[model samples]
Target: MTSPTIVTAAMLAIGDELLSGRTKDKNIGHLADMLTMVGIDLREVRIVADDQDAIVEALNALRSRYRHVFTSGGIGPTHDDITADAISKAFGVECIHEPKAMELLAAMYERRGMEFTEARKRMARMPEGATHIPNPVSTAPGFAIENVYVMAGVPQVFQAMLDALLPSLETGTPVLSRTVRSPYGEGDIGAPLTEVQKNHPETSIGSYPRFDGKSFSTDIVIRARDATVLGAAETEVIAMIEAIGRSREKHQP
Candidate 1:
C-alpha cells in the first residue's frame, strides 16, 4: 500500500505591534484551523517585528524548512509595512509596482473619490514574479511568490485572502481526530497514556488538562490521517482510562 502524503506548512506573523502586545494576533489560530481542514499541517509559527532584516531571516528559514510558508502582517501602505521588500530581498528579486495591483488600487481610489497618494500606492509594490492573492475586503491584494504567501495584517482581509488563495494550492488527505474525555487528572493517567502512545505510533496523542473550580479532568485527543488508525488509538485510550478508574475504585474504602 502507498503511504499517505503529508503536506506541512509554517507561519510567519510580522509586526512590531504584535511583539509589543498592542495588537492581539487572531490570524495564527484561523490559519491553523483552515490549513488543517485542507490537509496542510502547520508545523511551526514565528512572529517577527517589522524589521527588514528580521523578516528576511525568518522568511528564508521558514520557506526552506516547510513545504509552504504563510505570512500575515506588514504588507500594508505604511512605513513599517516592509514585508514585500523583505520577501524580495530574501528571494534575491527586485520589488516593483505590479501592474495589476496598481490598476486595482487606482480604480478603487478613484471610485471612492480618494487621491492615489504615494503612501497608498505603496500597496501596489510586490516582489517580482509574484502572483496576486485577491483581497475581497479591500482593493489592496496580497501576493504569492514561490512557496511563501504574503497576506494582510487585518483579520477580515487575511481571511478573505486565504479563501481566495486556498483553491489554487494542492492539498492532501485530511487528518482526523477523536477526543476522549475523562474525569481524572492527567497525572493519574500519565504512565498508561505513554504506553498507549507507544502502542499506536501512527497516531499522535495529546492530553490537555482542565480545571472546573473544584475538579480536575483531562481530554485526550488522538489524531491520524487514517480513520482505522484513529479509531484504534481512541479505543486503546478509553481502555486505559477505564482500567485506571477500576484500579482506583478497588483501592478505595
Candidate 2:
C-alpha cells in the first residue's frame, strides 16, 4: 500500500505582548485550523519575544525542519516590530523597502487622508527576494521568502493574509478524524485504549477528559489519513467503551 503524502508546517508567533499577559494570541489557533483544512499539518508552534535573535533562531530551526514556516506578529510599522529584519538576517539578506509594497501602502494612506510617514514606510520593508502576501484588510502587506510566511499580529489581518496566500501553496491529503464519547473516565479506559492504539498503528488516538461539574468523561478522537483506517479504529474504540460499560454493569449488585 502506498503511504499518504503529508505536508508539515511550523508556526512562530513573535511579540513581547504574547509572552507577556498584555495580548492574547488568536492567530495561532486560526492558522492551525486553516492549515489543517488545506491539508498542511501544523506540527509545532513557538512563541518568542520581540528580540531579533530569538526570532531568527526559531525561524531558522522551523524553516529547515518543515515544508512551510508561518510567523505572526512583529511585522508592523513600529520600531519594536522587527520580524522583517529577523527574517532578513535568517536568510542572510538585507531587509529593504520594496518599491511595490511602498506604492501600495502609499496609495492606501493617501486615500485615507493620512501621511505616509517614515514610521509607516517601515511597513514596506521586507527581505531581499521576498514576495508580498496581499493584505485585503490593511494595505500594509505581509511577506513570503522561501518557505517562511511572515504575517501581521492582528487576528483579522493575519487571517486575511493567510486566506490570500493559501491558494498559492501546494496541499496534501486532508486528515480524517472521528470522535467517540464515553461516560467512562480515562482511568476506566486507559489500559484498553493503550492496547487499541498499539493494535492500530496507522491511526492516532487521543483521549481528552471532559468535566460537567457533576462527573468526568472521556472524548476519544481517532485521526488517520485513510477513511478505512479511521473508521476501523473508531469502531474498536466504541467496542472498548461498550465492553467497559458491560463490565461496570456486571459489577453492580
Candidate 3:
C-alpha cells in the first residue's frame, strides 16, 4: 500500500492595507499554487493589519497549526514595514542586522551614487538565527525563522523569494492533476463526480463552472499523487464529459 503523504501549510499575508481592502492580496493564490505543486496543502490563510500585536498573534497561531508557515508583506524600507520585527519578537529572537543584506544595500547605494543612510540600512534587519531567503529580483532578501518564512510584500520580489526557498523545502510526491470540460452545469455533473470521489477516496474531485458566449459549462478537475489512480479517475472523467458533450451536440441542430 502507498503510504499517505499529506502535509499542511498556513499563509499569513500581513499589511494594514490588505486587511483594509485598500490593496488586494495576491500572495495567497501564488503561495497556494506553489505549495500545492510541492504536495504541501495550503490549509489556512490569514490577513492581518500592520499592528505588532496582530502580527505576533497571527505568527503564533499559524506556526502552531501547520508544518510550514509563510508570511508575506511589510518587510520593506518604509516605516510601516514591521513584519520582520514583529515576527522576531513572537519567536523571542532579536532582530539582528544581517551583514549580507547590509553589503547588498551599500553596493546598491554606491552604484546609484547615493548616500546609504539609516533608512537604506533598514533593509538589513532580520530575526536572529534566521537564514536569508534569496530575492532573485532584488537583493534586500527575506528570512526564515524555524518553519516560518518571512517574505517581501512586492509581488515580483515575493515570487523570487519563493523560487529560492521552495527548492529547499521537504516536498512529498508531486501532485498529479487532470481537468475535463463539460457543456453541462456543475449541478448536473455533481452526482457522477460524487460517485467518482467515492470510488477513489484519496483523489480530490472538484467542479468549476465557466460562462461561454452562449451558455455556461463546468470544468471537472481531479487531483491525486499516485499516477495509476489518477489515470483511472481521469479516464472516467473524460468519458463522462464526452458523453455529456455528445448528448448536447445531438440536441443542437
Assess each prediction's global lDDT (C-alpha) against the native: 0.93, 0.93, 0.87
Q: Candidate 1: list runs displaced more than 4 Å.
A: 213-215
Q: TM-scores, in order shown?
A: 0.97, 0.97, 0.90
Clashing pairs in 1: none
Tens-digit lDDT track for model 1 on 44-161? 9999999999999999999999999999998889898899999999999999999999999999999999999999999999999999999989979999999999999899999999
Give per-candidate clash totals.
Answer: 0, 0, 0
Tens digits of per-residue lDDT for model 2, 76-166: 8899999999999999999999999999999999999999999999999999899999999988999999999999999999999999999
Model 3, global lDDT? 0.87
Q: Residue 242 in candidate 1 has what lDDT?
A: 89
Could you tell me which residue pairs clash in candidate 3? Answer: none
- Model 3: residues with Cα > 4 Å off, grouped in runs: 242-253
Worst 10 residues of 2 by lDDT: 1-10
Tally clashes: model 1. 0
Worst 10 residues of 1 by lDDT: 1-10
lDDT of 3 by residue, 1-253 (tens): 4885877889999998886788888889999899878888888998989999999998899899899999999998889999889988999989988888888879987998989888767788998888899876867889998999999988889999999999888776667888887778887788877887898887889888898777778888889888889899998888877776787789998
Q: What is the C-alpha RMSD of each candidate to the true structure, in Å?
A: 1.2, 1.1, 2.3
